[model samples]
Target: MGSSHQTVIVTFNQPGASFGQDAVAALEDRLVGAIEAAQAGEFDGNLIDCGEVRLFAFGPDASDLFAAMEPHLRAFPARPAHATLRIGNTEQRVEL
Candidate 1:
C-alpha cells in the first residue's frame, strides 16, 4: 500500500487563555499517553507521529476519531473550538 499522511490541527475555544505550568505539565503527560495509545492501536485510528500542537496519523478519519479523544484532554480552555484535518492533498475544516 502507498503512504498516507494525515494532520489534525486542534484549536482551543479560548484562544488567549493560559494553561499555567501545572496544567501544561499535565497536558503534556496526557498527550504522550494519547500518542502512545494511538501507536498501540488503542484509539479508533492510528497515530504515527505527533508534535506539541499537531497530531500526525493515518487515514482521513481524523476529525471523527480525534473528536472522540477530546474529552480525555484536560488542559483546554473550554473545549476545542474546531479541528483542521489534512489528509494527503485534501484539507478539511471541522467545527466542534
Candidate 2:
C-alpha cells in the first residue's frame, strides 16, 4: 500500500531565514491533522532544512492531499512557498 502512495513536497523559500522550530512543529501538527481529517494523506514526518524548509506527505492521491494542505500552507506566515504535487509519473508545481 505504501509503495503506491503519491507525494506532495512543499518548500518554503526562506533564503537566509527560517521559521522558528516551535512554529514549524505546530504547523506540521495542524497540517497533519487537517490532512487526515480530509482523508487526503499521511504526513511522512520529514522536515528538511537547506536554504529553505521542505515538508513532505504521501497518500493514494496527490491532488487530494494538495487540496487538503493548500489552505494551511497559504495561512503560513512565510511569504513565498510552493508545493510540488506528484501523481504517478507526473508532477505539478503550485505556488502557495
Candidate 3:
C-alpha cells in the first residue's frame, strides 16, 4: 500500500494599514497555532514550513485539508481581503 501526498498552501492577505505591529505579530502567532492544529485525526499531515505570508502543508487531499482549516478561518479576527487555498494544482479562494 502507498500513500498519496498533496501540497496545501494557505496565503493570507495583508492586514489593514491601521493594524499595529504588535497586533500583527500576535495574530501571526495565533494563526500559526491554528494552522498547526489543523493537522489532526484522519487528516493529520506535515506542516513542512511557513513564512510571514504563507503556510505550506502536505496532506492526503484538499477536502480533508480544507475541513481541518475551516475553524481557524472562521476565527480570524478580521476577514482577509482575500485568502486562498491551493491543493497541488487546484486553487480555491476562501471567503470568510
Best to worst by TM-score, what's the order? Answer: 2, 1, 3
lDDT of 3 by residue, 1-96 (tens): 124666445544554444344554564565456555766223222222222344455566655665665666566554353345555567777665
Q: What is the Cα-based TM-score of model 2?
A: 0.89
Q: List where candidate 1 sits over 4 angstroms from the true fold.
A: 1-3, 13-18, 40-68
Model 1 weakest lDDT span, ten residues long: 42-51
Error of 2 at 41 (Å): 1.5
Predicted structure with the largest TM-score when compared to the true one: 2
Tens-place lDDT digits, model 2, residues 1-96: 466899999988776666777777888998899898999879887565765778999998898998888889999987588999988878999988
Candidate number achieving the greatest lDDT relative to the actual structure: 2
- Per-model CA lDDT versus the true structure: 0.48, 0.85, 0.50
Which clashing pairs does model 2 show?
Answer: none
Task: Encode model 1's per-residue lDDT on 8-90: one tens digit a residue.
Answer: 65544444544344554455466557655655222222222221233333433555446545555433654455566666677
TM-score per model over all chains: 0.51, 0.89, 0.49
Residue 95, model 3: Cα distance from true site in angstroms: 1.8
Candidate 2 lDDT (Cα, 0 to 1) = 0.85
- Say what the RMSD of model 3 is: 6.1
